[model samples]
Target: MIRTFGFPELLFILDGAKWTVLMSLAAFLFGGLLGLLVALARTSKIRPARFLALCYIQLFQGTPLLIQLFIVYFGLPIIGIRVELWLALITGLSLHASGFLAEIWRGSIQAVPEGQTEAARALGLGYISRMRDVVLPQAFRISLPATVGFMVNLVKGTALAALLGLTELTRAGQLMSNITFEPLKVYATVGLVYFAICLPLTLVSSRLERRLNARG
Candidate 1:
């Protein structure tokens, strides 16, 4: 079976890889938008806002992604609201990623030197102005490596969406293997595609982090 791995099967796997990349990008972009709001809420002076952000982060992060997917895909219909598998998968992945990304960005903001904020305040910058002019720009430099790493993880996590019946790379590999009776070759191809997607990002992230550190 491994000896019989064909171009057709390999192409099918590559097609699935494209879907995985698309889903990952969707999850990351939507998650990043929500995560930024959550990060700001967590850092806000209002007690209720901070508490709400904390709860949002903790609830999602404390739950397993598989369980979250199940809740979205299966559990929602119980309330008379039906969601398509792809839609549910995207929602679950984005929400999960948002929780983690929020925390990551919050930590990055805190890692910005205290004096930067203080200096901004002394310059008569308001809260928003301080963040925009002084804190967030520097924090973004520190955050880029972590965000890239999270995106890689998010891409890997798209495989879990297959469990919800969204035909991603892993699910496509399973289907091909079942049809071809070539599990080893099929799975190996799947892994190679994933690595191909991830390894370059990993290298780029490492290089960027090094450059950032050197500049600082």
Candidate 2:
């Protein structure tokens, strides 16, 4: 009963790709908001805020993303927090993205010329106004390339969700391979799908980096 790899299989993978895109978007949206707060805390003059933000960034950056997903999906049940698969996967990915994005933004915030901050201060702008109106805008521009690069990584990282039974692209390939007994064909298609998704973002990231460097 070996089914051939055909249009149906391709459609199945595409469906999985759809979920992959959705999951990545959800993670990035939530993570970006949290990362902004963490970045602000990391750059705050308050020592405790900086210390706590540093520890958060280190915890995620220091560990494997797969482990994080496992802890969310499996470990939580032991502590009486039962999360569904979607919740666990998105939560894990969002946390991971936040850690890296926070660092990227923190550096960009600091890289904004000190004099610009001083000028804002001289105008008697409050801390919130200074960051909202001045510092964050420049930092956003400076962070674009790296942020997109990290997004590329995040898309690839979604493959790990397969381990938790999420049926994203990689899991689709696995199921297709198992049924068709055509691991090579199924996996090659998977790789192509990933390349199709990631290459444009890769090119954009490079273009952005070059543009930033030119302006520097």
**What are the lDDT figures for the candidates, one per model?**
0.90, 0.94
The TM-score that candidate 2 achieves is 0.93
TM-scores, each model vs. reference = 0.93, 0.93
**How many steric overlaps does candidate 1 have?**
0
lDDT of 2: 0.94
**Model 1 / residue 200 / CA error / Å:** 1.9
**Candidate 1, superposed: residue stretches over 4 Å from native:** 1-3
lDDT (0-100) at residue 14 of candidate 1? 85
Write the residue-wise lDDT of candidate 1 on 107-169 in tens digits. 999899999988898899998899988888888888998899899999999999787677789
Residue 146 accuracy (lDDT) in model 1: 86
